[model samples]
Target: MAPHHPEDVGMTAAEQPRQGGKGPRRAVAARDRTRQPTEVRRRLIVDAAVPLIAERGYKSVGVRDVAAAAGVSVGTVTYHFDSVQEVLSEAMVLHIEQYYAALSEAAEHATSGAEALRLLVDALFTEDTDRHWRMWFDFWHAGEQSTDETFARGQADRYTAWHRQIRALAERGVADGEFSGDDLDGFTARFAALADGLALQRLRQAPPLTTQQARHHLNRLIERELVPRSPA
Candidate 1:
């Protein structure tokens, strides 16, 4: 998979739609891989930068490093991006967008609330996703020293947006009668926190939870806490 390509947790790439499209369709421009559009080339560069920055913090990667990774010249990198920081920042945003896009796609086709929750857990706990969590850990730590309000606020907004996403999903569960709870705000807060804590533990702590173990733990939490309401 390309660096920016989100994992196919519950859906294949063919099944995934481009933004705002009803379904996946063949793109005329995409047919010619040899001659990529400027936007596509820029995305390729950002994609290459993501895992590198995720593995070795933003300060460590230079324009030449990104250009080398992207299989492009340093001049190409400069042409597409203003600086190394711009490249890294754009890569971070692209990484997060891919993440949200994956979850959104999975949730769209989910048969039930339980299935949706399971899909999310599967997406989050994969071996490949470990890098994603580590990336966030690095991003959060860097934000601590950042004096740029715009940058810090942008990071903060993503967290708030994620919380809202979880809350919306929990509300859907309640509405579908799959989960028996009126305190959806509390449910969202708790579950989101649980996932975050688990991610950090899996990344940093000794004797880390294997992906399977982590998935089972999350599933159990949903099954126990979000009890099904029996039909009348």
Candidate 2:
């Protein structure tokens, strides 16, 4: 069995998509591997690639490495994925989805919108989340280096979804009277950008930033930003 990926932090085994019955057609699989649904098998291969990329960096991991990590033949990896780029792209998406999943889980039980946002702030700065950040930096770096428009668009889509998540939280707070923001668009932009900056710093370890320190800085910012100030 392939080791569980970060997806397990949020999505239970039952929740990840499984559809040999639908979706676009993939390469013809080997006769021996046919029993595994195409989508499921592809996910297996992609999941295997995540840890390898995390440990080896995106440019360094290859088809052979994925095959070995997946315990499948190199032919099997090629059969399921059209190219190394395709495999890496899918792996990036899968890993990123895990972060959103974990965020949703963190906010699921909060009693108020403010609490949910605070929970999200805490969720974003932990060591476990830091691992996901490493992959995020790599994906963005890859997007920057490649002129592939499709890959760039995918990167934009993921980022847009993240912005949407943050905006939705702020909207929830406003609607419930816990927040008063004059410009959600601006707030969302700044807040997401702040998180991105912190995540990058955490990944670099240039000043030896610890998880506690990261969460503390972000939580303080969240407190100062989210709560409306009283008029003089």
Largest lDDT belongs to which candidate? 2
Which lDDT tens digits does candidate 1 get at residues 1-232? 5532221112335645778877656543333335557888888889999979977877788898997788666777877777787788778878887888889789879987667878888998888998888887777776788787877887988888888877777677888888887677777778888888889889876666788888887788777778888878
Candidate 2 minimal-lDDT segment of 10 residues: 4-13
Show model 1 residue runs off by greater than 4 Å.
Answer: 1-41, 71-82
**Clashing residue pairs in candidate 2 (N, C-alpha, C atoms within 3 angstroms):** none
Tens-digit per-residue lDDT, 15-75, candidate 2: 3445764544444336533456668778989999999888988899999899778766677
Model 2 TM-score, 2 decimals = 0.80
Q: Pick by TM-score: which candidate is best? A: 2
In angstroms, give how far residue 65 of model 2 lies from its true place: 0.3
Residue 26's lDDT within candidate 1 is 50
